[model samples]
Target: MAPENQPTTGPSTFIGENYHIWVIKIKAYLKALNLWEVIELGEPVVQPLRVNATLNEIKKYDELVTRSPRALTCRHSSLTNVMFTRIMTCEIAKKAWDKLKEEFEGTSRVKSVRFLALKREFELLKMKDSDSVKEYSSKLMENVNQIRILGETFPDQKVVEKILISLPDKFE
Candidate 1:
């Protein structure tokens, strides 16, 4: 088979921060390249070719084997050297991804604490008289996005309601 082309741009290197955003970007990147399954679902399991195996069997096996390394390579290239050191021994992308998630994502308690803080911020956010609607909305959404990074599915309807209530009386 011919060599495949890769995208010109990819996710930001993981440098011990913004794990959520990096994961989101990288997942999308991998999905676009049809490489996310190996990372998400782990490597594919295939049987060895039998003696006098058909050409199709060889091709299928080759593709499965090749994807494992390709996915691993994508993960390797996306990490900072310091981060890469943590996963240096990971020959599979799934293990590397899990290791990063377990380490940086913190424990459930830690995530809960963070989620609550962001939730409060989201709840208390109000537009100032001096701030434009766009600016105010942007700030509000930034907080929401951070909450999502924490793994909550913050509702779009709720954000819309908040935006409506946050507007100054002059706009009403």
Candidate 2:
């Protein structure tokens, strides 16, 4: 029985053709140009390093390479940090809020603002009558406002200011 026709599957081996040799030559060319790193798997497999990252994130990682937008290699940390920054921005938080609002509206629920106010009023009333309830309504209200601000889908000046203050200026 020919190996090609064998139904048994674990891992199968195959022979390479002249195209494989051509690919090796191209990889060599890329290496010479310092465009890519060629990882030689025992069977002549070439892995290109800089693949599958967003344009914006990649640009921040390496300004020179991003300016020309050439194929180059990157470490996983670089790619991960780019993705992390995009996710952490206030704009992403705002999208999440918008989606929540849409879902709440579809369910015929009272608006978030009205619901929050009513809840606060009830909590205050309970606090006045019952000492056991112990409601932190003001803190809750502040948190709600923060969430609404976060859901604006844009960067906030206050956030930028805070970040700037936290980091020491090397130049000054």
Best by lDDT: 1
For residue 39, give model 1's deviation from the true position in Å. Answer: 1.2
Question: Per-prediction TM-score, please?
Answer: 0.84, 0.18
Residue-wise lDDT of candidate 1 within 1-172, one digit each (tens)? 4246656676568888878888889988888778899998999997888999899899988998888788888888899899999998999889988898889888889999999999999899999999999999999999999898888999999999999998999899
**How many residue pairs collide in each prediction?**
0, 1
Residue 35, model 2: Cα distance from true site in angstroms: 28
lDDT score for residue 54 of model 1: 92
Return the clash pairs for model 2, or none. 94-151
Candidate 2 least-lDDT 10 residues = 68-77
The best candidate in terms of TM-score: 1
Show the lowest summed lDDT stretch of 10 residues, model 1: 1-10
